[model samples]
Target: MRALSYFFVIFAIFLAPLGVAVARHLADDTQATDWRTARRDSTGIAPLPAQTPEAVIHVYAARAFRWRGAFGVHTWIAAKPQGADAYTRFEVVGWGVSQGRNAVRVGEGVPDGYWYGNAPTLIRALRGGDEVDALIERLRAAATAYPHQHEYRVWPGPNSNTFIAYLGRAVPELHLDLPPTAIGKDYLPDTGVFARAPSGGGFQVSLAGLLGVTLAAEEGLEINLLGLSLGLDLSPPALKLPGVGRIGMSEE
Candidate 1:
């Protein structure tokens, strides 16, 4: 009996560390996976080829500008399987000034972590099919789940670009300071040609404006039947300015 008791005590002592090790491991995992601190995306958008979806449901975007130089860009896309009608909206908004030097850059360049630190849902919906309704519901859920305020980088000079992304919300009125006459509605012949300007002057295509509003109200960044083509050149674009030799950088 004495020997058995001694053996039992030894075994219990040996097992205690193993149990403690397991508990510590579980705690570490939980902390690493929590979104409040370090979030991760299981459904983020992939690279260009990864975005080539088979079909889509509904998409929208918009941009608003105030004469003083404040402007806003919004984009949203609702997508799902073929039989669904509801749509998901991803939206973003930016309101500030850039003394004409550069454009404000919103959201980080990482494709997966942009949506309030969550994965972008557009790619997932496209994979599902042409069901708009389902897509919208998913987007609504994501938007509801988004954290309220976040900071993004912007431009310093006049010739810069700003980009923003949305998670979910209804499209809002594009309040522009320019009179209807100043804001000419130059609809492009081919929907493909949504918006185009000489890189510096003001720009607003019906498609870009509409999509900006949609995204401002919804959850996705890329939307519409036509889709999205976003390019951020770290290297300056090919522009020949009298004073500024040739702006140059890289592309994201």
Candidate 2:
């Protein structure tokens, strides 16, 4: 009886938000477009490399393609070296992975390109001289050393979110605070069950990213179940829902 009650409580706390997320997704027309026809144009959110002489690093997250957007988001990192004429974008893409291509893609493209049709939200931005340049170098090295370069899993394991999460741990100074909708963000590779949160300001324990709890100054308190996260952010007095994301304050 006690076990049954506990299960119900957990279900209500986590699953309820997921249900709301589903409803919200269904009602949003922005996700109804087909992938092939979806807009991939830049949203003009990134600094133009030719016009900006300072080194810059940006983290972006957009709703996942198609139905997956209802559950989670896709994240990536973009950087520009001081005086560079182009931005190099780094992200794990599962599209050609089945064809034996590497999952980790590093190339030049629009720094703020849309994810399919969804406009990306800027998660973090840093601009400076030598310090930002050094951070970008570290980020590049971390991307090269990512363990699951040949693997891709859309849920509960090594995926795009997982890749960004790895970078966060590798370069804590980024202080990446991945939102709750980053489904695979909690997936720690061989790093064991307990590790620093993606934000580097907190710690989290996970069971293969399916179940976990995170506590941090930046991330607040998050409960991860079956790859969905629910939590409360006391600093901004926000509620972090599974699909709807943080609801109380503007991230900016």
Candidate 3:
């Protein structure tokens, strides 16, 4: 019992800085009530021009809505197959589910846009000849067949992160490197706790996204507690902290 108490104390000490950082971000005087009132333009992370290029796929993630941004991020996948004129994006949203609308939205839109007010960070980019096009096709199939099409949960399971994470698993060739701040990305669609990590490069055991452990090549090893994550990225020698996310020079 005493050991457990010590462990928690140490954890809190490490998490303290992240909490402060998030608090500072939210301390910004500017605020908005409606989601639409927030920014939605691209941050110029996408290299594809307005003309739209074929054989391209971009996976992006950004801080989630409102205070939740302090804890985790929302993720989405966008792809433009060969000869396609526009990009198709796939992601899950909770607000629509509450308003009698489908949780999953798939269609053409800005391949990269602000999530609420948070500028997006591109995680994976694949573009080339016919070979890249083949992977994009698989991504489309996996996205359309998402198991939780009508379901949505803000925390733990089947949220935006879950949607894109599932795609990474379905098509591992993309080699997704889901950030630790993507809170719901670890939820396995299966009845069992053990399953493939979102990167599809390792194994993970999660309990409805509340608690879990992951040991994967892309993500390294991580522990999820109370919807926040902390881990070590052995591949790049960095510390994955809760509120602050990854710290240290990342080779990625």
Candidate 4:
């Protein structure tokens, strides 16, 4: 019992930095007002020209609104067809289903708009080409087929990240490497202990997102505990922590 106690103490010490990081992130983004009044406009990350006559696909993630930002991020997909003027954005929104609408929302809003005041980070990008256009079709199909269009959960979920993760599996061409902070990305739909990893680069074994293991080139080897991911980045040689995301800088 003393040995076990020491083990737990060591584990808690290891986890302290990550926990502090998460708390700091939440404290920094906390706003006094409610979410409805929070800013949601483009944060200047989108292209200068909102309307583009080019084929492009971009997957973006931003901190979730309000308190949720501490634990994870919200993700969405945007695609523009050849010669299209505006981008088509696809994402799962709980509010939609709460009002008796589909959780998946398609709109002509800014492709890289800030998600309820949190700035976004581009996760994947593919631009102008017939190949990208083909991927666009697959993206649309994946969006239409999302099983959780009527469901949403803030944690361990079929939330927004789950929607994007579904597409990541369905459309392997996108090669979506969802970040470690995307809490709902591991919530597999069916009742199975095994499934393709979200990156579509390798394999994963998850017990309804509560616990899991994943191995892939994009994500390396990850152990998911209650939706928090801890892993290593094989290529970049970094540590993936729950609150801090990736540590170990890379040469850009």
> What number of clashing residue pairs does each candidate have, in the order they appear?
68, 0, 0, 0
**Candidate 4 lDDT tens digits, 1-105:** 999999698567447656876678757835425777777877766554345556888889987877677677899998888877778898998985776888888
Give lDDT tens digits, candidate 3, residues 88-179.
88888887687788888889888898887888888888888789888877877887788888788887777888888888889988888888
Which candidate do you rate higher for lDDT, 2 or 3?
Answer: 2
Query: What is candidate 2's lDDT per residue for 14-123, written digit by digit as tens?
Result: 77878888888899886747878888889999988878999999999999988899888999999999999999998999989999999999988889988998999999
Candidate 1 residue runs with Cα over 4 Å from true position: 1-59, 65-70, 86-138, 149-252
How high is the CA lDDT of each candidate model?
Answer: 0.29, 0.90, 0.81, 0.81
For all predicted structures, in order, the TM-scores are 0.23, 0.96, 0.91, 0.90
Model 4 stretches with alpha carbons more than 4 Å out: 1-15, 29-32, 48-52, 250-252
Inter-residue clash pairs, candidate 3: none
User: How does model 3 score by TM-score?
Assistant: 0.91
lDDT of 4 at 191: 51
Candidate number with the higher lDDT (1 or 4):
4
How are the candidates ranked when ordered by TM-score, highest leading?
A: 2, 3, 4, 1
